[model samples]
Target: MEGIEEKLVVSTADVLDYHSILEAVKDCCALFCCLDSQDGYEDKMVDLEVRGAINVVEACAQTESMEKIVFNSSLTAAIWRENICSQKDVDERSWSDQEFCRKKKLWYALAKTLSEQAAWALAMDRTLNMVSINAGLVLGPAVAKKNPLVTMSYLQGAAQMYENGVLAIVDVNFVADVNVRAFEDRSSCGRYFCFDQMVNTEQEAVKLAESLSPLISLPPRYECQGSEVYAERLRNKKLNKLVEGTAC
Candidate 1:
């Protein structure tokens, strides 16, 4: 019940009302910040993400029982930027350049990058335990139909990402599992890049297109006949360590 009397000032809103967030997280040991913005409102998405993250982290700061926060973020936050080729390895430490995102009109990437940054800054200032899951384009049953905006936004620079060997995907189930494991395992710290497949080859790209189905258009009777290979630069060593630790 420590810090229970600390009153935080937050803007009024139908959603993300400060009091509501505080009440919901009361006595909770852990928090998962999985936020998304609707596709059409690109202009307001950044503001929404930044504000939502601030409110959530501020609330967690007031809850003494809060042990850790598992923030769900997209790999786009780490992969988009100029001169990606210069970086030998892209990992949790990698961050997308905000200026590049704005210049390219990659609103989703900007939103995630800024929001996650905001959350981390506030969490560190408040001394709250936190970890982030920077996942790739999440794919699962009916993904295109269920999360069209998010899925498409993550793929905005698909060609560049693919060429850089950073275009990747992870199952929705794997993302969920990672979030939970990161929360429960105290050894898990900082950021973990979660992905299962990298779309570097012609065959892999075709498979991704097929998985996204009608959302990603393919030529009539398109077929994948190449086993082309590209060196994948993104790494998930931290995530592997977490999985290994859990299996023990």
Candidate 2:
């Protein structure tokens, strides 16, 4: 891959620092907000996510050059809780129940849901153009090491997610591609669910557990017939519409 500098201008600024973020967004027509907490800092994840989103959206709103903002969110923001199966389908329009998230101590889901909600609220109020990509567990090379916080947080209610058939995965590269598509495609609006596969089978679940080993582990000599596949209720129709006729 080419060096980042060769392809784009990079800047460093704390999301909490409104002035710095405002300055960095200047002269930029589009912005991608992919912010998250680091390892060992999960306790502050909700505060950071909500405030960071507000700050970033406010910055984008203040800039005359800003035309679009692509926000990165999580499928966990929509998949948790017990009654989800009763719904006809889990799609971009669905949102995780905040009370359920709190009851289950799913801070990551709470954080993403609240932050995305905050962003949408401000963007609509300011009449700013924005789109959100609600992605699944992003798996790619060194994902466990590079995105430990998000990965672990996403798996917090693994058994429930698996039982509900909402456990899903998406390639990091695909997520990145979708973000770019969402920003460039004028027709893309609102939220899009971005997942490549569902971990609804014993085989797939085992594979996922194996991949995150050390961070995650399986029983000794574990084996499965790999034939048990759970029903999948999650949908990505909006994402399909956004990428239709385009290379994705």
Using TM-score as the measure, which candidate wins? 2
Candidate 1 TM-score to native: 0.90
Which residue pairs in model 1 clash with each other? none
lDDT of 2 at 13: 84
- In candidate 1, how many clashes are counted? 0
> Against the hidden reference, what TM-scores do the models get?
0.90, 0.94
Poorest stretch of ten by lDDT in candidate 1? 7-16
- lDDT by residue (tens digit), candidate 1, 119-206: 9999999999999999999988886688888788888889888889899999989999898899888888999999988889999899
Model 2, runs deviating above 4 Å: 1-7, 40-43, 245-248
For 1-248, candidate 2 gives per-residue lDDT tens digits of 56766877678889999999998999999999987776623546788889999999999999999989999988988887669877768997789999998888889899999999999999999999999999999999997788787689888989888878899999999999999899888777889899999889999999999898878988888878888888898998778877783322
What do the candidate models score in CA lDDT, each in turn?
A: 0.87, 0.88
**Count of backbone clashes for each model?**
0, 0
